[model samples]
Target: MAPLRSRRRRALAVPVGLALTASLGFLPGSATAAAPQTADAPASAAEAGPELSYVVNTETGAGTVGKVKKAIAKAGGTVVTAHDRIGVIVVHSANPDFARTMRTAEGVQSAGATRTAPLKAAGTTEVGKPEKVREPRSAAALAAARASGQEPLESLQWDIAAIRADKAAEVNPGSRKVTVAVIDTGVDDTHPDLAPNFSAKQSANCVGGLADTGKGAWRPYTEDDYHGTHVAGEIAAARNNVGVAGVAPGVKVSSIKVSEAETSLFYAEAVVCAFMFAADQGIEVTNNSYYIDPWMFNCKDDPDQGAIVEAVSRAAKFAGRKGAIHVASAGNSSFDLAAKSLTDTSSPNDTTPVERTVDPSKCLDIPTQLPGVVTVSATGPKALKSYYSNYGLNQIDVAGPGGDKYQVPEAPAKDGRILSTMPGGDYAYLQGTSMAGPHVAGVAALIKSKRPDASPQEIQWLLKAHADNPGCPTEPYDPDGDGKVNAECTGTQHINSFYGFGIVDALDAVEK
Candidate 1:
């Protein structure tokens, strides 16, 4: 199966999300890098050689970064920025042995390069160009939609009504004080629907592992980077009699771009930067619609994967402690996350993928599977699992309206898909866990708006408490027209693999 993340909003036939497949030429075993040099090696070995990106994880404590700054510099690495709170430092170095030398430095826990390719490789490569084409809605449909207390294109948004967002808006349109940070590709703050409530102060680009707070830094600059803008609209599109309305139309939205311009790849240091930025900026909720790129499952036993898991886990846990409720997609590969053993062929995506059998419990899908994070599964308009949504009893915490073209929601929305703003001030219909995660994030924001003093844990409990639990279906599962069964739902109403705690309820979140 392809290891796509949840943001590849191209051909519906192609899976959304980061692809697990790798160009065979770059496979881990097939390729090699400069081995670590001895401490007594030539002085030139520690001098500047090739500028690379590295994530330096320091020993947890105050002054951890300061303690190792001299050592880092001696290794020919320059500190780009450091999250002293989490002990993660982003560095740029030309030394081939920067990571190796830094690892032996006092007060440094772990250090590794964030990508397989050099820092300059990303700029030269092109990836993740949007391929899907959406047709404009007929004038008659637009007119009829406006007549029914909806925006011109709102009639196509069954997702808004799926969670009863329209009713919730009547009761509570959310609060500007509560912000939902879109930690994805990038957001187009210029979109009319998003501009009204966009929080520029809270936005930044963490593309190269360091946060860039310049103007428009949070907006997508590459082709097909509208995924983040789409997610932002899903959470807090303006309620002004405009094109569409979000779940919490009044809540503020901020963009935190973590992916590269073309690849759409999210590296470990970049993720660490995003969480640290959100925590410091008082972002109440963060919507993580894509997985950390390259590896679908980061096994703790693997040194490289383990270091990434450790660094990102520290960042995520710190964000939670600082009061940001992280909501991430459960991925779109349809793999049962709770299974015992699974074969995964796509990994190290920047290079090549090698098929390997892994125990699901030992392999983790970061941020989503991390502790304290609310993992979300996707449901179509029919409230069934999206054909591509991955499910597991222990993995899913809630469900949301992730459109499925096969089983459309209700009338007024002819297509079975989620409609939201696109880049360049347009709109499109897209589906995936990428879409569903934002709905839950919006609802979380609404809950925060209602209870401003509520802690992240309290808001999490409220989300589960306010959800509408639909028991597992008794019928056999077969989403596609194929003759074979596709999935099996198990568990009770309160907790299940298919629907999780249950479909998120916006109305219940605000009123209950």
Candidate 2:
């Protein structure tokens, strides 16, 4: 199965060294729950099963939430925390039937296990297999690039140049008032390119469903956890003439580390916390690069999946309601997310995955597929859709320079992937819609800086309005140049499957 885009990339290389990369407690009626026993109950409440996390959705009311909490306690679950604003309570349960029992309770809109795996255990994905540089730049070429009157490595950042971000910077380098939170693995804020504009106050470690704002709380916890750092650099790596420049170098960026340390799995609870934190922190935008874990597509027909959806959806909407625009990657699977049916074999990804054919209408990729979130596709240096970017008409809101393996960029960049800040104050080249999302997030930050009073919905519309749609190709898209057509394009030039409203125009975002 295609690995999710959180770190999706084929082996690529750069001249630089291959440096690839909470908690709430609800203290409620401790001893007793008034609810009755459940049929699907485990052998004994004393002998708890594998500990699991679940989300219990309910209507917003003190009486309703109180009764639901009582029911949860009775079902052998502990309230991890509750988002009173969204009426979503996070629960940890060792009882195998806890979700089943909670669903039968009054005032519970939905309930389900948040993951297939027990707490703390998660499946791992390799960062990427490093290979020889595809287009190695000569020493003279490197020197010439460094001579450019921008960040030392700015000349290597073709992705920035592709969207005219280099030009955009001179006009309005963005605003310190605007902050885009990287809601992914974690970001290395110490990187010289990112530190100057990093906003520690807005950053946190949201793993395990709680926000930890301790010093260095929001940093990559493991060696391979470099995705968020790369993403943050793409958005606002500071124009300090050190490393590569970001799309909106003047903007402030905060890291919201949500993915688990060992497994890199992005659980629903952590995702919800990140969104809620972003909303409460007054973040102008957030970049979500992965599908919620366990299920690539959360099918509402299923009880547990439905609860995960409701809980996360509520959090995302709450962020929007509070004026935070969320920009999410369209995924790296290359599946047409708007199609009738799609295959998801790597779902329940924290455990053994079961292959299933799912309808796009029902099963949704969280955050990205949610309403009011700007869904982004990726493009190559040539402005063609990246080979691995997921796309669809109406489903995608914009496209960005995500890099393409088949469409190699020129020297200095020296690879078909993107270059951004990595952990350890270094930089590396990687690619995915994961990379694309941040570019758009940077543009959205620029928009937020320009139109500070605009709402999330308005900024989203403006993103499309300023996008430069390449128009649907008359012929089938074959970016890889194989005999077979890779993916078909749909919709009109103004709005299509391949390029969305077209590549996001950062220059116009500031100039317009």
Best of the candidates, lDDT: 2
How many residue-pair clashes does candidate 1 contain?
Answer: 9
The ten-residue window of minimal lDDT in model 1 covers 15-24
TM-scores of the candidates in the order shown: 0.89, 0.90
Q: List the residue pairs that clash in candidate 1.
A: 3-20, 4-17, 4-18, 5-17, 5-18, 6-17, 20-346, 49-94, 50-94
- Pairs of colliding residues, candidate 2: 21-224, 22-210, 23-210, 294-348
Q: Model 1 compared with the native: what TM-score? A: 0.89
Q: After superposition, how far is residue 511 of candidate 2 from its true place, in Å?
A: 0.9
lDDT of each: 0.77, 0.79
Error of 2 at 463 (Å): 0.5
- For candidate 1, the lDDT comes to 0.77
